[model samples]
Every structure is written in C-alpha cells, then in structure tokens.
Target: MHAHGGTRSGDAVPGDEELLARLRAAPVLAGPLPEFDPAAAPDSPGPLFAAWLTDALEAGVPEPQTMTLSTADADGEPSARVLILRGIDSADCAFVFASDARARKGRDLAANARAALTWYWPAHGRQIRMAGPVTALGEDAVRRDFLGRSEAARAAAFTGTVSEPLTGTQEYDRAFRAARALVAAEPDRVPDTHTVYRLRAREAEFFQGRADPFHTRVRYVREGRAWTRTLLWP
Candidate 1:
C-alpha cells in the first residue's frame, strides 16, 4: 500500500496516493453561499465579519464561532488547534480567546507574540482569516472570564497543566472533582495562570466560495486608524 514503492517497517501501509484519492472524492463546499460583492463590502473587515457571522447564525451553522488558532514556538515551529471564539471587538480591532498560561500555547506565545486565527463556515462556503501580534489581557479580565465558566471548565482551568502526561483518567477525575469542590466553596478561585489573549489583527481576509473555481477573496490591511482593502485572485 506504500505509494512510494518502498517498504514501511514491516507490512506496507496505505500511502499518499490512496489518501489523496479519498480527499479528492470528498465533497467541496456543498452548501449555498450568499453573493459576495467585493466592492460593496465594508471598508473594514470587522463589519464584514459581523455581517457574515450574523448570516451564519441565522442559517444555523453549527459552532459558527469556532475557529482554528495557530501559534508558533520561539524556534518557529508552528502548531494549531480548535478553540471557540470568545468575542470579536471591532472597536478594539482584536479577536479574543482564553487559554491556560501554563499550557504549551501559552509558552509559545510568551516566546512569540504573534499568531493567526481562522474561521470556516462550510455550511455557507465562507471563511475568515486574521493574523497579527498578540496581547495578554489584564488580570481583571482573565478573572471574569474564568469565573464565568461552568464548574467543570473552572475545575479544568484551575488545573492548567494540559500537555503533561497523566497517570490515567482516574487520576484526572479525582483531581477534577477535588478542584470542583474547592471552586464550589470559593467561586472566585481564578487561577493565576488563566489568561485571555487578544490578537490585534494587522490584517484580515474574507473568503467567499463560488460555483466556479474562481472564488472571491478580499483582504483588509490595517493602516493606523484606517484600513486598506485589496481583492485577490482566486
């Protein structure tokens, strides 16, 4: 099954060609997307993002606010994972999400203060991309965000060591229950490591899929108090 015609360890395993074929056969943007007029789009990406988000909400796109956060280590190695979009403030020109400051991503951000976020609503054939420098929000904001979480989330946040190896699920369950009980007694038990980081976007892009291969893409680059827009070829 190895496409390279080379043996892999012992028995051959399915290789690149099979996976490529499967990927090619999968559906490509099967949903209806609203018409996109690049020229008519708002000058700033914030308003456009808000409008698309509204449409996605009305269309019942599941987890419309879920986005992929990409960050890199000091050495430039990159990693990405899914996270819920906590908020988007057009006035501040930032996208917000929370993380445990003790986690690997937190360490990565400490070494490098820039990251990227991407949101894909396949149900509407739309995507939003933002990349820029990061800023750790104030402690007061972090405390509020942590206390607002559910008991389970608060418990998990209380124990921010996610990447470390655990003895077993039982170990975690025991710790989680203990933390939950402690939090129940004191609702303001926000961990010192809990943080809400904001990505102040240097640029943002909006992508709208089309029937033809040539889709639509508009990029907004920040220019101090103003923004410059550019249309990219699909």
Candidate 2:
C-alpha cells in the first residue's frame, strides 16, 4: 500500500517535520584525490579489494560483502537486487548467490553476460563498483556450496520461486511441506534451482570518503587480458 498520501502516479514529498534532528553528522569528502597513488594501490583489483575489505571489517562495517547485482533482460529491461558475495577469486573475480531455473536474473545472465555489482558501506564512507561479463559455474561447484548451507537455510531456499507472485499463506505452506518432505527423502541431493554465477569483472571502481574535502576514486579497466588503472576526477 502507498503511504504518506502518495498516489499511483504522483507522491507527496516529505517536509521539514519528517527530517531527523541530529546533533552531529558524519563529514563527506570532496575535492581531489589524496596523496595515495592508485597505480601503487595493488597489483590487481582483487588484492586491492581484499585490503580495503579488511579495513572495512576492522572498522566494523556490517555485511561488507553485501552488494547489489544488476542485470538486464533480452529486451533491455533492467532489474537489480541485493545478493551476498559468496566468494572472491584470486583474479579479483567474485561470485553471488542465485537460482538458475527461477528465471529473471538467471535468464538475463544466460542471454547477456554483461552485469554490474555495487558495494557500499555508508558508515565507513566506502564504495566499490564492479562491472563485467558473468559466467555460470559447474553443477558440482553449485552443489558443493549448497550442501554446505545449514538445513534450515537449504529448506528456506526451496520455499519460494524467485520473482514469482505468491498466492497466499496456504499455498506457501503446502509448498514448504512438499519441499521439506523431498529434502527428507533425499538429503544428499542439492536443489536443482540453487545456483551461483561468477562475475568476471572487466572494470572496477573504488571510492573512499574522508573527513576532508578530498575524496578518492580509482578506476580499473581491463584491456584485452590486461588491466589498466587510472584515477578519476571525484
């Protein structure tokens, strides 16, 4: 249901009363890049990302690997959803949780390998964006990961068809019962719908915000098989 008296085609904007009153707010960085050199950051985007990720964890950013996965259908209709970063390769590539037979994003990936992932930790004022072609991993790899999940999680995974409309609680309960029975019968088998897509990045951009006005943005682009790094104007 729409809230704040918003209409289907139009919505009322919140006024000053809706704004929160805080004594202090975190500062945002501006201006130019700091003394740090992007070229010397790391040999590859993956290692550089690892270093930054470590810092974020040390700083206590929640779910640092949680990123937004963006994909587009064959007709160019775009869709994006948040997905946990399941794994990262030595080559700076990453994998995300998904389902193959559930359609939507999976179908889009099958047709178009191009996709993007964005990770932002507002509390730490850090953001990482990666874009590239995606590749579906082997069934063995998917099964291995699926089997590693807790039984509850595996059961939950089987409860719903992604991006599909739900009828009601009764329908869901029936499906849940069926899924539980199937799993009970064959606990060794991984659900065919559970899959993972590894995103092989062709480009990556890192942003770091500081108290000072000088923010940093480093962009890395792949040329053929080699990566070329550059500093962008923030």
Candidate 3:
C-alpha cells in the first residue's frame, strides 16, 4: 500500500530528484485573483501599497503587515529577516520598524544606512518591495515606540545584548523573569538600546501575479519631488 519513493508505509523518503519534481508541480497563483490595471495605479506607490495591504487584510491573509527586511553589513554582506511593519510615514512614504541597536540588523544599518523591505501576501497574489536609505528616528519617537509595546515585549527588550550566542536557557529565563518583575514595577521604563528607524523609499515596486503567464509589475521611482511609474516585463 506504499509508493516506491514517497513517504508512506514502508516507503523510503523522497530523494532529491523526486523532491525537485514535486516542488515543480506545486500549485501557484491558482486562485480567483483580482484584476490590476497599471494605468489606474496611484501616482505614488505608497497609496497603492496601502490599497494592496487593505485588500490582503480583507482577504484574510495571515500576518499581512509582516515584511522581509534586508540589510547589508559594512563588508557588503547581505542578510534578511521577517518582522512586523510598525508604521508608515505618510508625508515621505517611509516605512517604520523598531529594533534593538545591538542587534545584527541595527549594526548592518549603521554601517550601510540603506535597507530593503519586501512584503508578500501569497493568498492575494501580491508583492511590494521598497528600498532606500534608513535613518533612526529621534529619541522621542524611539521612546514612544518602546513604551507602546506590551509588558512582555518590554521585558524581552530589557534583556538586551541581542544577537549574542546564548549560553543557556536558564540564564536567559532568569534575566527575563527579573526584567518582567522590573517592568511590572515600573511600566514606563524603556530600554536604551531600543530604537525606531524609518526607510525613506527611493523606489517602490508592486507586483501582481496572474494565473496565466503574464504577470504584472509596476515600478515607481522618485525623482526630486515627483514620482515616475513604469511597467516592467514579467
């Protein structure tokens, strides 16, 4: 009752070729996707991105506000991680997020001062990419962002030294428990290492995947105070 290669009763695990074949056969964009018209897109990508985010939210996409943040070190080594989008600055189309200055990403940003953010809502068959120079918000903004976090989050942030190799869970748990108690006693306390950063996008791209071979890619570039929109071959 078992297949020769697939994972089943008395069957061996799939080999590399079998796995590759299965991957190629996987379904993608097999959905009743919404129509997108590049000509009707907003003058600026920020509004269009907001609209797509709303669409993904209404469509019940999980973690619609999550994005992959890509940063490069001083040596030009690139790294990426997924994190929540804290907020958006409407005035300058900047994407905001909070992190510890001691973290790897913070160090990378410190060296390069540039980063990229990418959001993909597979359920909605949409993607948004933005890249530009990143700058730290003022102390007031950093404090507000830290204080806005929940008690548990605040405690976690207090146990700083981010990106350090953990010696043991016991040590971390002890520090975290003490931090929690401190947070409970003084709710207004904020970590000095906590910072809020904004990436003022120089360019943004919106991609709409279609069931057919033709996909939609609309790119927007900023020139002075004006934005130029163009379609890319998909």
CA RMSD per model (angstroms): 5.3, 5.4, 4.0
- As a TM-score, model 2 comes out at 0.82
User: Which candidate comes out best when scored by TM-score?
Assistant: 3
Structure candidate 3, residue pairs in collision: none
Residue lDDT tens for model 2, 1-234: 576755556655455655333313424433232245665787568777787778778877798868899999888999998887888884654555556557688888887878999988766667889898888788887988788877766776788786789999998888888878777777877877777888888899988776564668898888876778888888
Q: What is the C-alpha lDDT of each candidate?
A: 0.87, 0.76, 0.89
The model with the greater lDDT, 1 or 3, is 3
Query: 1-234 in candidate 3: lDDT tens per residue?
Result: 444745576657789999999999998887778899999998998888878888998999998878999999999999999988998875577999989888999999988999999998888788899999999999899888888888999999877488998899999999999999999999998787888999999999988999996999999999999799999998
Which regions of candidate 2 deviate over 4 angstroms? 1-39
- In model 1, the runs with Cα more than 4 Å from the true position are 1-20
Residue 15, model 2, lDDT: 58
Model 1 lDDT at residue 144: 76
Question: Pick by lDDT: which candidate is best?
Answer: 3
Candidate 1 per-residue C-alpha lDDT over 1-234 given as tens digits, one digit per residue, 9 for 90 to 100: 568967579765668999799899998876566789898988788888888999999999998878999999999999999988887898656899998877888989999999999999988899899999999999888877877889888887765277778898898888888888888899888888888999999999999997776789999999988899999987
